[model samples]
Target: MRILLTGGGTGGHTIPIVAVVQELRRQRKDLKLFWLGDDHPEERAAKENNIPFQKIACGKFRRYFSFWNLIDFFKIPAGIFQSFFLILGFKPHVVFSKGGYVSLPVIIAAWLLRKKIIVHESDAVPGLANRIAARLASKVLLGFNAHSAETLSAKSLRGKYIFTGNPVRREILKGDPVKAREFFHLSKEKPAILVMGGSQGARFINDLISRSLSKLSEYQIIHSTGVNNVSVIARSDCRERQSNLISTENHYRFCSYLDVAKMALAYVACDLVISRAGANTLAEIAARGLPSILIPLPSAASDHQFANAKIFEKRGASIVVEQKDLTSRKLVSLITSLLKNPNQLETMSKKAKNTITKGKYFLIKKLRISIFKIN
Candidate 1:
């Protein structure tokens, strides 16, 4: 079957698509895959997986009043025009959308051709793009089960709903801690804490880490500070080392972003995760059964990240810290407290593993059976 994957804007959208595609390839080698997006992560995922990628015009809507929204409105029509012909040429059997602003045009074009479209919503509260695409979807696959009507808020969205938990790349689950230590050159004396602001990197989190890194010299910190923020962190890291505030050379390891392999290694190497509460990242963390301190993005649309973090907190798998409440000192204290409480850590780890709502079925198998009608 020919599958055209459409999603982008951030790692949250692109990574899950990669995970789903990875599973599909394992199950069926003959399946032809194509990706459509105009972003580095999307293009890289396609190239890394050897799927053909084509860039397309993409536009987004703002919830709040914005001058950019007026400008973006025009791009949608242009995007639709471009997407229609792209879909016409590819002749895909299905369009799997991971629900990003970039995907609305593709979903519409696929709908125009009478092609089946499947949408996966990775947030507890759906984004506007997904909310619009959900109207046209044949199957609306949810990353989290929708308990409240807020997730599927529109009355007109009549698609079949399936709660197939967010897909985590299989390679992410196959990490080796021994190799991680070697690869990261981590000291065996201290436990490692993985700090990430999600795929794009968070300046907010980076600032917090920068202020706290010297004080956080008690544990190894492996930070993914976003690609754009690397130099900023690098300069700070140098100053900290030069000032001898950080006792060891290997105390802090940082990068702009981590590819799949490096991310897997980081997951296994770290004892705890300090990250943004994006559902895709949370899915991987839960799959790995790692205890975490979740700092939700304060300005997230619909306050979704806060909701996502609360779900983990309710499960005892994570502690939700609103960005407003988070401080460098608070982060250090939380890490210290968790390290001191091994029993709590163990329980949280167990909860994280069983956090999967649809635990019985493999995500790809579910997709095959649901979409392909495979018995």
Candidate 2:
């Protein structure tokens, strides 16, 4: 079987497709895979999976007025032309699209080429790209619940939309706590905290951690400060100890990025997760039954991250704090209060694992064999 995976512009779009590609490779040895995406960020991730990749122009459609949007209007047709030829040459049997600004043209080109298309929407609400792609897709997968996916389209298209949660890297499930203790040199006396802020524009969370790290000395902290903001860690007395990963000031550590293995260990080692409400990361955390404090990106497209976080909050899986209300003092207080109640944490974990939509891979496998498969 030949499969062309399409999505980009952020790790949220790219990572889920990578997880699906990993499952595809594991299920079949004869499959041919190609990735068509935008931007340089995920090219390394694609190559790491040994899949050939092609970059295409992406024209974002904004809800508000922008002069750049007028200029970007032309890139859509150009991208379609590029994607058309690529899809023709690849002649993929199925097109797997994780929706983002980069994917709309790819979806149109694949539809024109008459390829079977399956799309997954990771946000609680569908953005313009997925809202458009859902109409063209033969099967629409939802990272949230059925009601969430149902609202993405009209009642007529409901048959195509299926709730499959979100795809998580299989390696994320295989963490060893003993290895994590030895490697990170974590103290057993203090509770561990994992802080994440997605791949881009993490300065807000970075600053919060900087202000609050000293106040939360009772806990060990590991902060993933996005690649561009790692320098935020080397302040005051702490200097650069290593390359990507740095150990600083008693019980604190920081890293620019976390590959699958490192992320797995971080999940198990930490008693609590503090993160932005990206659906991909939330899926991984939910899979492990980790309770979290989610600070959603208020400015995200359609304000979908906040919407995603609210679902977790409503389910008793996480505490949602608005960006405007977030501060060092409130953060420290929340962390202290939550960590003090072990029973509440356990209840949160149970709700996280039990309440959210899950087991996406099984349905994904069924799609590959049934609706998506072509001889």
TM-score for each prediction? 0.91, 0.93
lDDT of each: 0.81, 0.83
For 1-375, candidate 2 gives per-residue lDDT tens digits of 898888888889988888888777777888898888886666877888888999898798887899989988899999999999999999988898988888989999999988889988888988788888898888888888764575675876778876667777788888777788666789877889999898663778888998898899889998887766543555432234322567778888887777778888899899999999998888888888999999999889888899999999999999999989999999999999999999999999988886553453554565445434433
Which whole-number lDDT from 0 to 100 does residue 237 have in model 1?
Answer: 63
Candidate 2 lands at a TM-score of 0.93
Clashing pairs in 2: none
| lDDT by residue (tens digit), candidate 1, 25-135 | 777777887888877778887888788999888877888899998998898888889889988888888899998899998999889888899888888888888888888
Worst 10 residues of 1 by lDDT: 239-248
Model 2, residue 125: C-alpha shift (Å) = 0.6
lDDT of 2 at 314: 93
